[model samples]
Target: MIDKSNQQSFQRLRLNLRQLEVFVATARGGSTRAAADRIARSQSAASTSLADLEAALGVELFDRIGRRLLLNESGRALLPKAQALIDQAADVQALFTDEYAAPLRVAASFTIGEYLLPSLVAQWTQLHPKSQIQLRIGNTSEVVAAVAGLDVDVGFIEGAQTHSDLVTRPWLADEMVIVAAPTHPLAGRLATAGQLADATWVLREHGSGTRQIADEWLLKHLGQVRVGFELGSTEAIKRVVAASDGLGCLSRHAVTQSVADGHLVELQTRLPKATRKLAIVLHREKRLGHATRDFLAHCSGVKQ
Candidate 1:
């Protein structure tokens, strides 16, 4: 006869570390084959491990979507808890085994990620050699969502977010400048609001912070602005502006090198200066890691 307490412990042990590992890998990799490659296991082993995990949990974690596996609702619900458990386990191990903790995970929008953060990250990593720094770069909205959802420790975005779940602090000011190639007809002319409206405009994709500010500014002054093309990346937008007659609005940081090299010319406009508040955002309730806090201090000018 099995002892009652022993039975409960045995049942709990079924959802063991191996199961957690497989589940996490599958969730992240989105397929058994990919998870197997990530964990250095055979595809059959990964599939068996996932089957064991689902059986132990008594819940279907993923649904097959064509050839790929996607997290089902239960898997989606379990993801954060599983991640937190793993993070906590790593933290506990660090407490006992490691001399220093792991590096901070930080996310930021593309403009800052590409131009501003590399130097800052390098400087911070140099100052603390044992500390690791990981960065995730996305559009402004994606960064905000990541921070809000606790997918990233913190994020920097070039626009204001009104979400109540996030605490946003203004870190810096950024400006969007209208630009075109030197050969474009508007290159030398001081463009009036109406003339600016008449020109073909290449714009950033919808979710970009730069696009939001540009839209608001254009709507207010030009009554309505029509976009001739929508490109997903600043680099692509710059290329389009450089090779064509279309005008583009881009962060000053993004186009600085081009402007200096004279590949792109800033279009002087009668419109008011378009400024945006770059903000550091984090969840209101999350406790930030020491490395994250240190980086935030550096960004806020509270530290060197």
Candidate 2:
């Protein structure tokens, strides 16, 4: 047990908020390079911060396994504490600032970010002109991590993937539709597994909620389909698929506009389950901020 009463022992500690922030980033990213990108730091600088943190605490936070950095027991235990510190710091930063002006930090997975959140946020902001919203978009894994780390007030994720630290509520239903360019061979007809296998499939990068569902559907039906390219954004994938012979699995919501604009064609393939529920995610222990709760309520089907 750490003794808070020991003034001499407390004086010897050299840890600071930056080191804690670095530790949390590394844990969330699972690698020094990814952590550096998340925190906007150089790889060497992030590594040095981690090293300093470990030395100050007299314990190794991450287990070095080949090129991957896995959080060891110590690292896992320290994560929540670090997250709490970061959240508290944000609270302190907002203390004297106008509450309405403080941005309602929202994290969302690609599908929701591209299709739904913008319009929803826009509508809400018209009602509360002073309210501000900042949307951070990432994959399911990243959004879950951000919510668990208290980096965002709320998150919306597609599919049934749930996190232990988040309270998930079924928000909306989304359909996964396979699409292609109007000029492609599979454009207006039913495509078989062999036909789809022959064409290039442009997919979202790994860890995306849409990608996770798409991978399962492809593995079961298309068996070892070739991915021509992996992209980070739903809009980017839709544009690429509209211009190339590549097939893309994306949210129906995401591709609806493109299909209507005569740029893309929806393929009729037998999918195991084309449907999944989008969930509202929030840290189990974190209280919802006023603006965030209002948006969340809107998503949950409340007329307000």
Candidate 3:
């Protein structure tokens, strides 16, 4: 027991989830009425909640223009903190239920998301049957952007793509292969740089991690080459290359099944081997909850 007079006084917290939730919804929806609809509250109630939050913080979180509410610098600063607190509170509530945990939000680039994560996610779900995952698939640029923006809990990306706001951990090693139809002249033969350079290629789009690496590898030896088609999907590139005389550079994992099925043949070339490191990325400021941490541990096991 300490003396009552010596005890330090602390300020009582005026912030509440209701106010934060209202504020977040309003920020996302851009209007109080829109927030009301989103959170299933009356327009007046949403407006009141937003007003209370602003008053408690003693600063206007939003800038008013006509009927719209746009986040100012202060509001932008507070948004991620508010979202984290809400997720943590939900995690606490979920502990008492039969559910495994709060939903894990993940974004992944094309190769990992399509060829890799399905089996890993299925394995994770088997161990924790009630777990929920929301996975968004895009290219590495989008994955990096998603993690940097705090739009997802974590991201998996291919190649050396990175962001200053993200911490990248090398998660797996992957190889790239050049592929073409079996009937193509380069099939089953070691080709010179001139033969490779003269070939028309079908490759991924400009923003893709695969394209970045492919360009680095190809441009270094082959110089300028003709692009027959630029596609967004790895599968689309595989199919187009298999049907036409055009060649493709893609992940070995992405083209393995097609190569096995005789739909596409791996080309032997004199160019140096292409290999890349796939990485797990997270925002520097993100606070990992238990579910996210556990999932990361599960991912680490794959390298073993």
Candidate 4:
């Protein structure tokens, strides 16, 4: 049913999945050997496939710097397309196997990854038992970078962090609470601005989303406070605050259990309630695979 010109155009397709696979692996791993190791092929074969792909496309996709093969402008432009194609092909293969296809790569900030996602991920896995999900945990800034750099299919983060290359949607509402050990002087009474400003605090480190919000809230309410310990892990901050007389400001979800167990007490402060928005982030051009779309819908409580 095709015309001569259309038939000829169809016949001119020279790109193959194997070549694209090798190209993507090389771009991610930065070497032919690494790509070969990923795809279970010889180094020479990987190199040849990459070379053939470039020759067919009539452009160099990578710039060789010493021994590393970094993606050039052309390669960067083609990577998302190649990744999408590979994922779609896997989906096709999974059709006959009765399994979900394509590994879902997700990144999340501390609070969401620690307190929120575990239950959600468990529920998702119950529905899609054969699906594979990989999660990377970092602070909000790192989560934004991962999504923007195309290293993850989607990201969940806390706070109002935004990037030009990502689309962010508000996912959940969270509250920040100030806590202290049960025996701490301020634990049983309302904290005055002067007392809060004079107290020693154990807080999250500088770059974390919790720290950013805590800084803004505390500084607005009680000028400057003495930071006794700056820890990276929220659990560590909780433990340190419980053992010492210092206080911690953290997500309510993170501290509720401890407060209920009587290990930590929520401080009754005069400061206004501190609330933050947790968000979902994704690269602007990244195509969502079936599993990812389902997971997002599940998180959003959308019946899709």
Candidate 3 residue lDDT tens string, 1-304: 9755555422346779999999999999999999999999999999999999999899999999998899999999999999999889877887658545568899999999999898899999999988899999999999999999999999999856547888998898889899999999889899889999999999999888899999999999899878999999999999899899999999998999899999999998878898988899999998998789889889879642
Clashing pairs in 4: none
User: Would you list the clashing residue pairs of candidate 1?
Assistant: 103-132
- List where candidate 3 sits over 4 angstroms from the true fold: 1-92, 95-99
TM-score for each model: 0.68, 0.65, 0.69, 0.68
Give candidate 4 regions above 4 Å deviation.
1-92, 95-99, 302-304
Give one digit per residue, the lDDT tens place, for model 2 in 170-230.
8888888999999998777888888887889999998888998898888878788799999
lDDT of every model, 2 decimals: 0.85, 0.86, 0.90, 0.90
Ranking by lDDT: 3, 4, 2, 1
Task: Name the runs in model 2 displaced over 4 angstroms.
Answer: 1-102, 159-162, 302-304
**Clashes by residue pair, model 3:** none
Superposition-based RMSD of candidate 3 using all C-alpha atoms, in angstroms? 13.1
TM-score quality measure for candidate 3: 0.69
lDDT of 1 by residue, 52-129 (tens): 888978899999989789999999998888878877877777753533356577898888898888888887777767
Tens-digit per-residue lDDT, 133-161, candidate 4: 89999888999999999999999988666
Q: How close is candidate 4 to the true structure, as a TM-score?
A: 0.68
